[model samples]
Target: MPLHHYLIVAAALFCTGLAIAITKRHFIGILLGIELMLNAVNINLVAFSRHDPEKLSGQLFALFVIVVAAAEVTVALAIILRVYGRYNTVDPDEVNDLKK
Candidate 1:
């Protein structure tokens, strides 16, 4: 397969994820969007790494990204659950407690 094809798919995935993250009102939905974007990045990294002649830096970077993403999701979900316990909702726009 061509490099451009992988890039195009990555672009589409990233755009869709961005749109979802911006439009979604629920915290979980936003998280899903973020995961989508992360996966798209992984695809790009792997695709580039396939063409590398020396060290597989792109693949290594992608591995770190996945690890970081996992940690982020864990922490974010914990926070989201805590907020839900307090406010009984996950809509970020509605959580205006910071203004107080």
Candidate 2:
């Protein structure tokens, strides 16, 4: 109902995402964390845009962010799949070198 409430939720989601990104060893897990952070950002943008009816810049930016995130996930998943095929592992720490 209030902006602060949204802000708090976004902050929590961002913090959780950051923690996940830092603690996860798997590439897919890290990607999930990044996606969570992006969603949190979108929440903030939408919440702010709700306050301003004259301009929809925040909402527009959020939409752009969604598109970017979608593209990012697509590219990332493709790369991850390739890496797994080549390395036979999804753990980033295990893949010290890109060369075979």
Candidate 3:
């Protein structure tokens, strides 16, 4: 309801997303974490948009973010699929061909 409440929710979502990204081993799991973080950002954007009745910039920005996130996921998944085809696994640690 209040701005502080929205901020707290955003913080909690960000923390959860961060924890997931840090602990996940699989590529898809990490993508899910990123999606969570993106959703948190969207929530914050919309919350701020509600406070500003004159301009809709925050809402517009959130829309652009959603579009960009969709494109990113599409490209990222394609790359992951190719990597899996080569490595036979999606584990981040297992795909170490670039390791020195």
Question: Best-fitting candidate, measured by TM-score?
Answer: 2
Predicted candidate 1 versus true structure: per-residue lDDT over 1-100, tens digit per residue = 8888999999999999999998999999999999999999999998899877486999999999999999999999999998988888899988987633
Tens digit per residue, CA lDDT, model 2, 11-98? 9999999999999999999999999999999999999998777789989999999999999999999999999999999999989996
Best candidate, lDDT-wise? 2
TM-score of candidate 1 against the unseen true structure: 0.93
Error of 2 at 43 (Å): 0.6
Which segments of model 2 are wrong by more than 4 Å? none
Positional deviation of 85 in candidate 3, in angstroms? 0.4
TM-score of each: 0.93, 0.97, 0.93
Alpha-carbon local distance difference test for all models: 0.92, 0.95, 0.89
Query: Which segments of model 3 are wrong by more than 4 Å?
Result: 98-100
**lDDT score for candidate 3 against the true structure:** 0.89
Assess the local accuracy of residue 47 in candidate 3 as a C-alpha lDDT between 0 and 100. Answer: 87
In model 1, which residue pairs have backbone atoms overlapping below 3 Å?
A: none
